[model samples]
Target chain A: MREPAPRSYRAPSTALVPAVELRGLVKTYDEGELSVPVLRGIDLCIEPGEFVSLRGPSGSGKSTLLNILGCLDRPTAGRYVLGGTDVSALTREEQAWVRLHHIGFVFQSFHLLPDATAAENVVLPLFYAGVRRAERERRARELLERVGLAHRFDHVPSRLSGGERQRVAIARALACRPRLLLADEPTGALDSRTGASILELLLDLHRRERLTIVLVTHDPGVAEAASRRIFMRDGRIEDDARA
Target chain B: MAARVLRRHPGRTLLTVLGLAIGVGAFIAMVSFAEGARRSVVRQFETLGTNLLRVRPGSRARAEGVRPAMPLSDADVRLLRREATTLALVVPVARRTLAVTTEAGRVHRTRVDGTEPDYARIAGLRFAAGGMFDATDLGTSNRVCVLGVTVARALFGERDPLGERVRIGPALPARVVGVVAAQGRTTTGSDLDDFVLVPRTTFALFLGATEGYSSLEVRPRSAALFEAARHELTTLLRRSHGLGPAEPDDFTLWSPEDTIRAAEETSRILGALLAAIAAISLLVGGIGIMNIQLVSVSERTHEIGIRAAIGGSPAQILRQFLAEALLLALVGATAGVLLGVGSSWIVAHAMQWPPSVSWRVVALSAGFGTVVGVLFGYVPARRAARLDPIVALRRE
Candidate 1:
């Protein structure tokens, strides 16, 4: 490998730089003496500003793949490059730093802190990133307003409806201005009408900010809305389609 | 954030705080006991003029502290006055607590002191009105007395106590010939102006209970000659008493500072016992905090998952819980210190001693609580930080 050029605010501008590129990515969990392989050899590349949906059956390992992509879990045998950084080789604390700056996660059931105000939940990532108090709060307010939760800043999760809580979670995911956004069934617990509103809000952010997104869901209708879609079967990608 | 977490479980937080406060408070209050006692001893002894010493008939192996002092006679006083060149004054005093009844039948419990005129001058007593009994009065065994201002007021009301008669104990009637001026309050709570004094010659005929006088109150001419005075008195007493080279002298000498030291030595044992109890209490409180924190980590596993998922590192999680523990312990320790200091003040007031708060103990106890918070809080915080993000999130 040749020595790389010193990077700047603008990422290396090769003609077509991929936002996320994984090669032969594999993950295995050791349960006692049994080594359970979750992901087999998998190859995928996502370009910047693309909205990609992942859909599969329950045991198809879509969630595991998303976890690996989000840097919440490590890949056992693979190279994962996100925005020109080889994140797979980083240490655990370094991975947390990578996730803080490059990866955003919105979970199913809208995992906003139950006792914290909406603004507080939004400021969580910035806190880990060591942002100053005034700056973190300012960013929290701006992000909540962007997610259409401007009036719900002080409300805890219990006071917010399913759609509003999901919006807060989405606002939190964008707190650090992450390069890649990952949603694991962000709308699964909401009714279809509320779910559609959340999907619309995410789409608006994606288009306006040109954020690269990877969303996993079992709903075919949800999968069809993405610019690109992938199908996973038994820990391997079976199909990749572009809209 | 740590405060918010504690507020979510008000009952648990209060329980941990109460445990620590009780421990810290007990420790502070107990240490203040020794401090207050020492302060009162200093105050009490300062009331006695400096360069003064007491010589009694027995050695104070008498750190045999509670034993009664052996008696000294008028002959000892005469021997010191005649032979000891370093001595300024030698006065023999015998004392007893007796109820004095005024002519109008009023009663007061007071110390009846039997001594000559030199006793009044050495004790720094001044006359508010009448003068002390002269040496002529002592040599003649006059039935005359001098009353301290407190007893004079209690027994005489506003009437002139001069030439008045008061009964000592049950029968011996002595006429009040003079009144001493008001000496202010003593911290030992004993009223310095609450006694009556009569000539030692008269005291023997009236009380008639003892074989000889209580002890000799001796003073050197100046502070510079104090050691010389002590040596002179010891040599003269031994020679007069006919002690041989090997025989230990029968008399003991007391300086005011020695009395203060003896009092401190007695309180030292009590101080140690209190410290042990306080240490045990704080340890128990620390263990309680650790056990509760362990339970807290397990119960909040899902929350820990959420924190990690949102970009919290293991170190960050550890710091958060550790801060929570410290916050709890710190609050408890502060409350306990205030409680302990307050209780100490009240006890000192009740005992009529000035309240003394030991600030050193306050800092030590609070610092110990903080250390305990870190020591005990570490295990649970580490366990919380090490949770697997996926499994933690998977829990309900």
Candidate 2:
């Protein structure tokens, strides 16, 4: 079958902007009079088509930084830019728009709506984007096929296996043709064999689509799959290296 | 999608719908019965003829401690005939409970109505055998009587006694001049077939002269003349009774139209009251909907988070939940309308009354159900919309 043409608006090719940038980012939680800081003075840049991994132990603020990067939450102090646009001063709704147009997320739990069919879950982002019903269905079917779950299009999340459910989630995350894909412990809930297959799928997608990905995990084996890796300890990055 | 969500919890959805259906059904049944009652009253008046008027001796207002007003006299009746020009006929009636025995010794006590020859025409009485006493018999104070169906059946059974004499009370015997056709009941719920009729003069001679006639049944030449005849009778009666302009009239004038209107108004008020009571149950149903919607919002918090993370706006989330609630209520209301109409039909059938389902009432109930859905659905939808994506996702 012929590949489906991208339908989303593309950024100017000559702009030369990194896919993600964060300068002196900080996050704090207020509990009455006490202030608990989660991320401290983090600076990072990720170019287009780069596959980066954030490796940290529990409570090391890797998830916090990933959330900020995905536009799910804002940092207390930061100069964050994505795809040539400064998004630090964006409102909640504006951040949501940015996420809709630029970002995709894959969680460890897959997060497929339990009652929805695989195709229906894949078509949800397009539904919010106001795409017509027929086009959404067509695109959803194509995406499911690309993820090797075309036969399971009508299967609900509950009926699908964990591996199939994860594949459906990946299809859903890519529904809007987002510029950046954020995966938090994508293989955490899978058996090692399934996790390895899922990692291979991600690497295949990265090469085939020229996609930029940021993977967060504590597993060294998972981090090793990324072309570049950053190590964090105590809410601060301790090292960054490229293979 | 919204339907699928509801389908996930079939028990909750069915319970909510059943609650609403019961409420609507009750409202429909009450409205139908009340309408039937109103229609029955109108039919009753129609049978009695709308052009007829009843004159009785009592003012609309009478204090409890005051002595009862005197009965209308024969002189007052003569005076009304001479003065009231709009009246086509005046039929004086004198009623008393009397014991009558047949020659075969069958005895029964029943109401005896002493009236004029014109009373047959005014009261819409039809003869089953023989005929009413003419002017000659009434003028001579003949000892003749007409027996209603109930009286006739009790005194003679299947035997025809057109010329037989039956002893009435302890005073005198009267020949049966006619047998009245069966008239089940009057508009006032009195048994019409349970009485006998006698000439007014003969009744006066036997029962002794009272201060006045018991009542007067009057007819206008045409229905259009009823209001004029009523006004003229009222004026003449007031003037003859010597009442001042400031004093209330001592006589009450009732038209069939007035009685029918009053009955209709009363039923309308009662119907509204019953509908309001039924609506309380609907309100309870609405509360049930709200309770279940809240539970659904809480249960689907993770799903809501996922949608939000995938570009679902708060408005969209709000709309989805609201749609689910609205769909539930609308479906329930439709079922309720069917239930209500069906139950009303059943009740009407059981009672042998005509079912009266007004389309306006059905539409109003459906609209009310929809309003309830929107009102009760709001709080839960808002809660779902305001959910913080990060917290909601973390909840699981």
Candidate 3:
């Protein structure tokens, strides 16, 4: 006799809270007797699955703001709430843990380890997150497949193309399945055609995974792909526009 | 990741390891040379009778500048042979550092040791060929000689010097009766195996016109009799020389105990000096590691930044760099030890000196190398650890 369709065991998904909440964020760098303020009172909130772009010219502190938002850098004074934890006052290790668990960053240069293969690069964040080896490999392969670089899993950065490298970088950012994705000019290093393709791939993933993305870029064309854009100048917000 | 990183830089890593190996090899060789010299000296000293005691005229201070030989009259030898109870054998020996010529045109400046057949037992001479001079030869003052291996080789050259006669003084001829085995060279100043042994009476008749006897060797029955023999000999010499009770004795007696003490003091000083010289290589090796570490940090700036950015704390960065530095040093040290040992072997073979390979020296040298690495490499590793990830990633 034909058995009834097996019951699917599924976990519950609860819309808990906003992904990130920043209040009066300030970051000042000490340059050997000179104190340069990079961010002055940045107040912003990103909801779950929102694609927000930070746009500005060079020396506008957009990168600094993105760094703080990504938890890669800490503000001199601020209250940052990320994934239910107040992370601004956290120790470097705690901040790293938050970054490891709740956030992921993608740099403009596709900063994949040169000595590692594409799959290995993707699995790096999971390594720090204390994931089991077999599970990390499984996730790494799945992410590579999602980024359409499954065939190039074993290829090193040196052997990969610019677009391929960025895809690997994106795949790495998603290894921990972070709540907030921070892409700092992820397409800047690629040609226009390849950049567009990469952006499309990012948009597709954003839609499929419903992942919150905060993309930083100087290019309006790149910024246009996001649902919203925040313009910055001289370490202050100048304008904010929604698509 | 480390394995992959190393694999990627195979050439660089190999070159680094090779450089370390060279350093280690050199360290081993030099240490071996010094050790070999030490062993050679000890072996030579061992050939001199361990139970033998030497008596010479002078105080310790005076002995340092110029050594005056102990003079023994014919009456003194007769008295010691008849009256000395604690001594096994006491023979008056006069050694003059003089150049002797052979009819074959070979001239060598060597010691002419004058003693009787008892000299063999007193001086610990093991004859390789023929026989030592008996009491009859000494009584009649026969011009018979026993040549050392080196002297024999130089004078006779592959042919036996036994049954041959060679010139001692200008016209004085002595017959070579026996050839003593080459005991080897001494690290000590004295050339014990580079001399000829002749009858004591003959030496006194030929070379002892100005002095009665230059030195006297006394062999005690055992270690127990050494003190008694020394005391009795001292009193006898003082009395025979007619010294007053207030006057200092003219002769200084040197036993195995004294030789050992002197050797210990000298070895301590020599060991420190040699160790210092060897330690300098460790310093050089450490500096090499430091310089390489600094270069490595700079070379892998982007890599360090990436590691830091990817959840690696400062301590981890520090550990990674330090590990690389330590690994380099440890490899170099191992190489140095092997090199040191191998080089010592080569030196021993080339010089034909008894090589002594001290495990302590190897361990000490290796330890020093390791310390040098950590001390010097820490600065660079710290610099790498403290590298601002932002600046580092941005660094070209």
**Candidate 1: where is the Cα deviation over 4 Å?**
A1-15, A132-138, B58-71, B95-99, B107-110, B126-129, B158-160, B169-172, B181-194, B205-209, B222-228, B244-251, B268-276, B283-285
Best-performing candidate as measured by DockQ: 1
- Evaluated at residue B246, the lDDT of candidate 3 is 70
RMSD of 2: 4.3
**Which model is ahead, 1 or 3, in terms of lDDT?**
1
lDDT for residue B42 in candidate 1, whole number 0-100: 72
| Candidates' C-alpha lDDT | 0.85, 0.86, 0.77
Predicted structure 3: lDDT: 0.77
- What is the per-residue lDDT of model 3 for residues A151-243, given as tens digits with 9 covering 90 to 100? 998998999999999999888888867778888898888899999999998899789988889999888998988998899988888988889
What docking class should model 1 receive?
acceptable
Q: Which ten contiguous residues of candidate 3 chain B have the minimum total lDDT?
A: B61-70
What's the lDDT of the predicted structure labeled candidate 2?
A: 0.86
Q: Rank the candidates by lDDT, best first.
A: 2, 1, 3
DockQ for each model: 0.42, 0.39, 0.24
In candidate 2, which residue ranges exceed 4 Å CA deviation? A1-8, A12-15, A131-137, B26-35, B57-69, B98-110, B125-132, B140-193, B201-212, B220-252, B343-356
TM-score of candidate 2 versus the correct structure, residues matched by position = 0.85
- Residue-wise lDDT of candidate 1 within B121-220, one digit each (tens)? 7887889878899999899988889999999999987888999999998867988889999876665566779888988988888877565666788889
By summed lDDT, which 10 consecutive residues of candidate 1 chain A come out lowest? Answer: A1-10
TM-score of chain B of each: 0.86, 0.83, 0.79
